[model samples]
Target: MFTIPSPTIVNTSSRPLSETTIVRRKTRPVRVGHVTIGGGHPVVVQSMINEDTLDVEGSVAAIIRLHKIGCEIVRVTVPSLAHAKALSEIKQKLVETYLAVPLAADVHHNGMKIALEVAKYVEKVRINPGLYVFEKPKPNRTEYTHAEFDDIGEKIRETLEPLVVSLRDQGKAMRIGVNHGSLAERMLFTYGDTPEGMVESALEFIRICESLDFRNLVISLKASRVPVMLTAYRLMVQRMNELGMDYPLHLGVTEAGDGEYGRIKSTAGIGTLLADGIGDTIRVSLTEAPEKEIPVCYSILQALGLRKTMVEYVACPSCGRTLFNLEEVLHKVREATKHLTGLDIAVMGCIVNGPGEMADADYGYVGKQPGYISLYRGKEEIKKVPESQGVEELINLIKADDRWVDP
Candidate 1:
């Protein structure tokens, strides 16, 4: 027999409510190989390969692993001409094996030559606007005069013209990625080390790309600080709307160190922009390996109802009213159901917040008395079982409902 706690049932739905829906910003799509950014496409998840670009075999192995785990785009550094040339071989090997994963080259310093060389090999070239045109800020110089700034812009155009032409002709894309720590001196003098500075830094290159009639561009405004990252992206969106430029945005929080701290920082920055519908592609930067970053990306996207990959687990913090070994039971429950994708499973320690807390979850396991557990398929109690029997019963319930998927 089923035991229903008074007021246990709460409103639960499989889909998010209408009022909380995120309306993605409208922008023209930019194609990076086979993946599409903006234009109402799902936000793409991408990661950079830290392996040496010269290690074609190592890089290919890493890419294959990342591809299996659902990384849509992959980027590698092309700091030298050799690395740039290596990209062609990498692409060739990937094609020979039918990987077809879109590759991007992150170029700086000697970007123009590397970009030009890698343009035909990779789908996109990412250049940091701050480092592309100007040398690192020297201690002697404070700011650039108006004419000096114009000359700098002109020089940038001169350097970029050939590569821009090559990329345009080759049907390639560019990412003017601007970072908080690397703003050019002129921008710093004008706007200080703020979001305005980062936006201006990127806008300068964006205007350059536009003048050359190259529209296949994506932009990023990244900072290690979550607040700064969020502010920069918000400011960039407003500026893009003002300029009537709907270029796709790449979102990330740079140097977000590893483990829980990294995940929290990345989520706060990238997740906020995603929630506001302001990002086209996202990378969850962690100190860990690149392949480890993919699941976190999917997790953030899934929580926002933007994308789905694995099961969503909701477990309440244990409290005085708890009636079971929640940690052990929860682990057991997850181990059994981790492969279930797109389902919300709630493991509540006690009735206090069980039903209400699990209102958004599709299935719920709530602790009742010392050894008892109540199972719910969306609020209504389906059965009562002992603590020892709960996990198996949950699986049985799922199978009975025909919601079981082989792991």
Candidate 2:
């Protein structure tokens, strides 16, 4: 057997662990729902349920499931007056049920009534800036001039301003959610399609909001393309520093695909920003159901050392000396431990190589015979367990010992 360094990281024992090597971007704290953003909190995970706005029970159940899967915040689309009403019921249910996380209401209107109605219930009101009801605009005026375009934007801001004030006054949080696809056409026409243009447009509105004396805000500059999304956020972060504004950032790669491509796009865009300490909260916006996002979000945070709870698994790819069906066995072990948060388990093959791979593991299965397996933890053989009971035995061992618990 061959020897190699283990990929599984050691637990925090305060035993001379390596210091965080990267420099983090410092930003002020913002409260979104019950979770705190910025000011050194663990990076939060969020998911949006694309369900009926008035379906209060459906939305509440969806959010409860999201919470169980470690989603810190849940954003629901409030497309109309009815959906806004649902938010009121949803928020009341959340309070009565004793689920403490905050709700976010997403509104794409150019008006404030919806924002105001949901503001009382939601922790954050996500406003996708637009001229009030621009999607369903009035008939074209007799010879629309350039001022018409500019007027539409200003008018939209005007509609949003009072609502923004109401939200601030009523203690509702807000996120300036900008989409690369729907960048105000006039701004796109003026600056052309570029990262600087997108960020400039976002900051332009941000400044407009700031001029109103509102500071409790977060910002999102999302692009479907990973590089464009990365570029936009980096530029926005740089400008936020230049202006000394301290709003927590919300990060995502918008419309990131399903399964592998979506995962790759999100990882590339979100991962790049996170590695530089630029993002405060993250979302894996896949084309699939919201539940698919939870594990991916946690994995990204784990890779960046931004999250604490996890089961770090280390196993060797089958390479001949790997006795037994290590592949299938490792899969079983990993599958079993998905629900076991905050424990580190290692399933490896070969007595000679497996111990080194599991040197940092809390409980390990090194190699197996036809019926039994060799077990070790911290360089000592503990006991042998049947192959059938291996995964459960490992789990029971972890829960019994406090070694894997966060220090």
Candidate 3:
């Protein structure tokens, strides 16, 4: 039987009250192919391809494209038995052409057979609990009796047991993904269209999986509205704490539209939970190309100091006291040093804020005088150079310290 570990407690009375790091919630590690989620792993980034799984070559190409660009896991929708069968080809072609990218199959709307089929090919299987044993709504029915609820619950267990057993035996993972919009009819009637319903919906599925001794599970409670998404995940965590369940959570905001607002909405929901140390894996569902979502995922993780994938640039918003064209110089500095991962570079417009503001940066390019720029290694001003040669001087400084790599 699986047991949840006790949550870690730290004493900070002797130290500062504030912490600069995010303390992630304790969760058991659930491996999905070569990658592991939770158990103090770096938060994993994932995105789904929109291609039809029936087109095996197209799907293989799409998965490779996403995996090459740092999407740790790629999900493909398996709507029908045929699509589920096509994953066999997709997995084989990936191994033959590129590499064995960790793949997940999104199975929904009475997807027992589909899930079982695709589970043979993919590392993980994601199911919408509300749709897994889909209960179509009765427009006239207002409420469900306790017996009726338990009766349908039994049916869900019967249908889910095979998949759980299959995954448990195969050493694969399952995601109990609950969407606020798609709560089962019984859940909607029992708890209404709220976060409570979403949590309960996931809990029902979770209990069934646990009953079968299948514990390699990840959970997600996602909603398009930030408040609903946030509240549902929080409630789920509370319940899990009480129940001694330590399943890792997969965080996302489903159908977060496209473009700027989509990114903001995704960040608002995913970022908030991550700040509170809530998620183990994340997906930013944008209506744009799947490739566009990877950068946003890394940016969120980078901004939170959870992961460092690119140079961290610290630039001040220019003011009248500025000594150079701040925006232009910042751009030039970025272009020259963007490839330097794991380094913090600061661009400050004036000496007033330059040294102090960029004290923690690995390197700094600051406005020293009208026609010159100050170069810094940490807080010390190394030299002043002509504005035209500032970027070159920064590169020279980095090379001097043996940190420059050819890009």
Candidate 4:
């Protein structure tokens, strides 16, 4: 890949069959277990295990759950030697069993031990500058002078940098998952509480690691706030460009809450960056089981038009024109087809809007009589399916056509 891209001249056919102006950032590949992360991997979706590490079976069980939901990479917290010891067994179970998803070990504070124990078995290790600190503000902390915060920040990097050098020496795939909330206070003080400040803090670590000749690197900058997360990444990308760095970017919104709100917030942050072609991998952090992360991550990727597979569900918001109990039918269809595994299906209220709405679906349904729907496979009606059986019939038709997914 070239450091600077050649200028684009669009061939004139009147419409775009290819993205003419999109310049993909040059990146080297970084593999995590069976899956690839950076350097043009297909924007993989990942999640982490939230189970107790001591229970190896339970931890593997959590990984299995994430795998079933289409998670490509799953991370586990290895805070102690016990958790570190379990990684080899956990990896053995994953490769031998069905969930061959790659494993990442989250190592904080105790960097040298984490490196010593997990460097061999795990595919990736997460290093955070903030993890070295106790994360406390002492009494009258709000009134602390600038120097105290600066010292706190400096002390953290001093605790963490040796591990970056050690991991580099050990030749391990390392991901620097930077925390926006715990950014070095000195950087924050110098650059203010802005996205530039966040990027400056992260780039510091990247520079340190790069100085050690560690080329196998992935970077993430996560914030609980959506705008902060977005702008920080934009600024980081800009900075990386200026420095000629092409590390794979990990897209995420940390601590996003649960269910609809969480999904939306994650979409708003991670989704925006992805849509702009800036993300290479994604993790949607919710304070829930890792299983929930997989589906949401897949959905976001699907929405971005990056991954194609079994089914795509498109439903209309109920309106005056809607008939045949649209909302009820939509819920049933969505629930039934959730496991389609790259399946594309759309459910709509009436042909008054459904056909135009679902022009892209592999199989779709629009309102007919009170108990029927207009069944469609790419503009041609195969039959009028009974509304009660619409969900099952559509899924079966997809299965028959694709011959790829397990029904």
Candidate number of the best lDDT: 3
lDDT of each: 0.87, 0.76, 0.91, 0.74
Sort order, TM-score high to low: 3, 1, 2, 4
Residue-level lDDT of model 2, residues 1-407, one tens digit each, is: 12222222222112233556444567778877568887778788999887786887888888888988899989899878888988878878877885856788888855478887878788888887533345443354233357776676677677778877887787667888888887655555555566666677677668777888877788898899987887778778777767878788899999998999999899999988887778888899999999999889999888776785677777877777776688898888877676566556778777877777788777788775557787777677887888777777776676567543322
Answer with 1 or 3, whichever has the higher lDDT: 3
Tens-digit lDDT string for candidate 4 (174-274): 88887888765454445656666667767776776776677778889899999889877877787777688888888999999998899899999988777
TM-score of 3: 0.96
Question: Which ranges of candidate 2 are over 4 A from the true structure?
Answer: 1-23, 98-100, 130-157, 351-353, 368-373, 379-407
In angstroms, how far off is 167's CA in candidate 4? Answer: 4.3
- lDDT by residue for model 1 (190-293), tens: 77788888888888888878888999999999999998888788878778777999998999999999999999999988887787777899999999999889
Q: Rank the candidates by lDDT, best first.
A: 3, 1, 2, 4
The list of candidate 3 runs beyond 4 A from truth reads 1-17
lDDT minimum window of 10 residues, candidate 2: 6-15
The C-alpha local distance difference test score for the whole of candidate 1 amounts to: 0.87
Pick by TM-score: 1 or 3, better one: 3
In terms of lDDT, the poorest run of 10 residues in model 1 is 4-13
Instruction: State TM-scores per candidate.
Output: 0.91, 0.83, 0.96, 0.80
**Residue 55 error, candidate 3, Å:** 0.8
Q: Which numbered prediction scores highest in TM-score against the true structure? A: 3
